[model samples]
Target: MNLQQLYYFKTIAQLEHYTKAAEQLNVSQSRLSHAIGDLEKELQVTLFVHQGRNVKLTRCGAFLLEYVSQSLDILDRGLEKLSDFVNPDTGSIGLSYLGSLANFVTFCISRFFEKTGKVQVHFQFNQTVTQTIEDSLMEGHTDLAFTTPFDNKNIESVKIGSHKTILIVSRDHPLAAQDSVDLTTLANETFVTYSPQCMIRNHIDEIFQTVGIQPKISFEALYDSIVLGVVSANLGVALVAEAVDLTGCHVKALQIENEIPEREIHMAWVKDRYMTPAVKCFRDFIMESGMLLDQYKKK
Candidate 1:
């Protein structure tokens, strides 16, 4: 009927002697008899037969013993698996990142696997457009996120590094011959820029305001690659991360003579969530060594 009762029956059936079973179980003979009696009455079956001074298991008792043994074994195994599941040292760790940090993040992932060999890592990429992705972090959809800094009171942030937003121009563009150009030099050039809410757009706006020049906007896009692709076609010059691969795009990254602050990259997570061992190891790994990525290196 219950675990204790089943255990009592199992011990008694194994010994086949009421007195010996009571002595081994450390219970009085009367107490053991009452418990067994209760079980037999509940099951409406005789589980033991008295044969002179000793006892023998009934047919039902032997069958029940086999099943109870298997049931207990399964429960024991389940407990152990549950214990392992809760262990912090190993398991899956979830992370979300901005697509721009791909190169830097991949480097860190290799380092993490080298240090913690057995942990399973999970990762997702988010464009970091609005509160949606940030809300995902807070709701436990991800344990960590690499993204542009934002004002979110529920999130905890760590400054990893910043990337210079360089000017990408077509190979045939007039300014491509120059090593660098001032922001004012592009004042009359139709610019390919990201959406208004994009952090890169904000930086460009700040530079324009500081130099007292309004950029002549020609095209706007949601993604940096599209903006770069357009610039490669000579439609216009665009500002983008210095690390963006311009290989087949036929674009060149040029430094800016006028001051334009680098776009910041940060690692953020929910403010007070419990970090598992795998997550903690990864978080510490990034915080301690993330700045060394070449994309983050200042040229």
Candidate 2:
């Protein structure tokens, strides 16, 4: 029920063994067991199941573990924020972005540091950048996020600009020589695609559904890099953000007509977050660097 109990439960779930968790917590195994038992009794849900020495989180335990993890992250960020207040300019700016926006992200970071010379920036990449942005903003896990737009009502987002969607294929593919190809043309072809949960994947699916076309899917990758690699290996073709360069493996772009609309990438933060100085500087830099504008104008 309390932070300590939640923390104890989380530690046990993570270690997967009461004895090891006790050793790590610097407490007796009996005490750790009692705490977990008390937590389960109060919450009226079994948190873990044990077979001899090995312990695994039960369904309820897995659910609670998520809550505990988020709570810990909030606490850690809160502490970091407090520490940052002691020295504003040198404070860390936690950033997360989609892999497809690597170039834009790199350019933005470079420009921000070069221009500001006062703010320290820390960046991380997430395959699901939109969800990462939403979660980070909602849970205070990050200071800012560069992500694609999503219909999450819990955050404030500024649409910087959009990035083009291009069809990529291996050199040996028959359609690789085409100037552009219709989505309908690939209806029966095995397609290599990113995970269905990705924003671009959803957009691609919508386009296919609208046109009454279904490409036979060969693979689904979690990362844009992997999808491009798969396509270049002649596994299948995919529509992806143009940030990927298919130079290595007999690759070519098959432009889709009526061009699938560019995905809108944005800078997002929690709606009511008290903006830290470092975070504000990073945000200002992104808006000023024209990275978004440049991406919008790409051929």
Candidate 3:
């Protein structure tokens, strides 16, 4: 009828003696008998019958025993799993980041594991654009995110580091010859840029507005690598974050002489959502090791 009644029935069914079961459960015999009597009345079935000086299960009791044992076992296992899920050193964290910050995330995670020895914390990583990352956080799909700063009342963010936005041109382009170029000098040049969905695109647009130049956008891509690939063909020059891997891309990352805002990286999470211990641990580590994480920036 209830958990306590089921437990008493299980113990009595196992030992087959009312006195022994009471001793094992540390309950008085009268209390155990009353609980069993109430359970039988509730179920309208006798669960035990007297056999000599001991007791044995009735036909219905044996059938009920099988189901009760299984249900209790499942409940016990569920409790254990919940305990492990809340453990700071052994739980899992769902982390999301921009594609460009993949290396930085790797560096931070490696250092985090090193500092917390014997940790069994699992990390699930998602690489996406800034808008999707923010959406993921808001929707509870991710526990933490590395992305560009945005205005969201329900999300909290802290600046981790920033990447210098630079101009990239093909090897044969005229601007590639210059060590540094002013923003005004490229006002007329056709530009390859990030899509409007990408947060960095907004920053790029702001810079264009501040410099009083309307960029003629010829191509738009979602990722920095794709934008670089487009620039490699000498199609158009692009302004992008400086920390991209340009190993096979034949584009020159030139310094911009004009003063512009750096593309800042931030660690963000839902303001009021419940965070597991592992997620909070990693979030605190990133907040404290901001400068250390900056050392692994792509050159």
Candidate 4:
């Protein structure tokens, strides 16, 4: 019913042991049990089932926990916004992006800071999958996200530019000397690739599917740099965007002869969401700096 009761319930639900929960909360076990019991009475529902040492949430308890978690998450976001407003000179901006765009995004961020040093930025590198990048924005976890386009009406996005996903192999690789190579040529070669959850990996998969060739994906990685490093180690070849940092790795980036569309990068945010001054300013700078310009100018 109250925040204290909900807090007690959440803690007990997580630990599933009243005694342990009490110790962790630095309160007496009786007090912990009394609070939870009062909460159950107020809600008119049995929230837990206990077996001597362990406690488990009943179906109603589980449902309540879901909503309780969501409420706490929203409260956290509100507090963050309030803090940012109170300190406008150093507004905080939460940014989310794919690993492949690290170099380009970093360049943009550095440029932004050069112009406005007072802004504080927090970054969430979502190497998991494309969905998470979008989710970060929609769930209020991040203010803005750089990712591929998705058909989510809840978001408003603007296309930045497109970049080519070039083929990368070790300098001593068998096909490295060639000017360009067909996708089919690498069919038998062991492949190092991004996780299937990655947007670029999905695009790469589609290219292979179109050519009717299934590559032997021996290893999976999240970042373009890591994939390239794995390839340079002669572990396997990979397909990564040209924005990947290749300074230290001895790798050859070959053009793919097969017709593959360039990867489209977009900056997306939740529609109608309040944009902090920091987020708004940097977003404008990013759009103007040409970092989002069509680097791969496809004919």
Candidate 5:
């Protein structure tokens, strides 16, 4: 039977009186009876039997009632979830970003939550490399990314801010004593850098290439923190974004005498994917806050 008939059946089964059920449902008793009669005729089973002025479900009716109750409950929950999904005040967002942007993302999220008091937006964070972030967006596994600009045509990006490249060397390293050093002088020094798959690695490679020298790479790590850790042990020197936290690492940051392009950070998403209200809320917040650049300036 149709959903309406099933609903009527459930209501009648619960109340156990046709007149009362019809009144609660805002329908005529005869209309309710005819609907149930049609349903029983379709199912070829007597659903109810008179108990004086009241009605009691038949054996078959009781079994059907159990299934109908479960099905209706499931449908009601589904409807509720759908409403929440579209509502800006509540929903979930799949957010991905580079490990280097962890602090910035945290600040943005905290501020966003503060601004939207009583909001219930949940974030699923994926800290990954630029390539994987792009793939996730394309595959619909991720809704937004704080990363380097994607080269894919299917991905759209907005430049959020830039990070000045800096050099990190061990505390005891000779260059650590210098206020600034030229890249040409470090041509023969061992370098600790991100893996080739990482977007920051590509930027580092470009800088080295621009200086007309190939750095002697001694170590490759996935994240900036790992690279800094390697440099702290005097394993090798590293070029990394200035935003990278130098808190616990015993590495000295140095300014580059040589001109280098700042590492650009972007907020990227799939070009043609449906954005949930939560996703839009976050994306818009970041875009409007100017917090990215403000944080960089504070640094």
Candidate 6:
């Protein structure tokens, strides 16, 4: 009926004597008998036969023994698995990140875990604001998120690094001849970009308005990869995060005659949430590894 009662019955059946089973189980003989009695009453079945100076299992007890043994095996395995998960030196750590940015951060995460050899990291692609993704982390849906310039007032975060937003043009473009291009020069040029809600898009729009440039949007895409594909076709120039791959494309940086804006990438967690030992180790590793700093230094 219950695990303890089942265990008592199993030991009693094995020894064929209540006194011996109780001594082996570290329980009083009366307590063991009472527990087995309660179990039989709950199950509405006789589990043992009493004869002159001898004991034997009932027919029902023989059948139940097989199942109880298997159940114990399963329970033992379950406990072992839970113990592994709770181990400080070996556990799983969950992480969420924006799609394109993973390419820049994956190496760092992989190397950190490899060196420690104590944590299993689970990574997810979650491209959302700090405010937006905080709920997921708080609700135990994710452990940490690698996000961009976010409203971090409500979340605990560390500025891991920043990515430069570059205006990329094809080699054949007229502006490619110049070492630098101005926002005003792009006013008449067709632009391929992400939706305005995207952090980079908002900054690009702000820069356009600040510089008095009114660029025409020829294509709007959700992903940087799509934007790059469109730009490779020479359909239009695009402003993208440096994490994007421009390989195989005749792409050239459109160095703005004025200053270009950059976006900060941050690793954020729920404020005051207790990080598991594995997660804490990873967090510390990321801070001391200098991988993000190295990435920011790249042109």
Best by TM-score: 5
Residue lDDT tens for model 1, 14-108 = 88888999999999999899999999999999999999878888899888889988887798898786555445554456666655666666777
Which portions of model 4 miss their true places by more than 4 Å? 1-88, 114-128, 288-299
Over all chains combined, what TM-score does candidate 6 have?
0.79
TM-score for each predicted model, relative to the true structure? 0.69, 0.65, 0.82, 0.64, 0.90, 0.79
Please provide, for model 5 over 213-236, each residue's C-alpha lDDT reduced to its tens digit, 9 standing for 90 to 100.
988997998887788778999989
lDDT of 3 by residue, 129-216 (tens): 9889988999899999988887998999998888888888999898888888899977789999999999989999999987889999
When sorted by TM-score, best at the front, the candidate numbers are: 5, 3, 6, 1, 2, 4
* C-alpha RMSD values across all candidates: 6.2, 14.3, 3.2, 13.0, 2.2, 3.7
Which runs in model 3 stand beyond 4 Å of their true positions? Answer: 7-31, 50-56, 170-180, 232-235, 248-250, 290-293
Candidate 2, which ten residues in sequence have the lowest lDDT sum? 119-128
Among residues 3 or more apart in sequence or in different chains, the pairs in candidate 4 whose N, CA or C atoms overlap within 3 Å are: none
True-structure RMSD for candidate 1: 6.2
CA-RMSD of model 4: 13.0
Cα deviation at 250, candidate 2, in Å, is 4.0
State how far residue 60 of model 4 sits from its true place (Å).
Answer: 44
Clashes of each: 0, 1, 0, 0, 0, 0
- What is candidate 4's CA lDDT for residue 208? 82
Candidate 2: clashing pairs of residues: 171-250
Model 2 CA deviation exceeding 4 Å by range: 1-88, 119-129, 247-249, 288-299
How would you order the candidates by lDDT, starting with the best? 5, 3, 4, 1, 2, 6
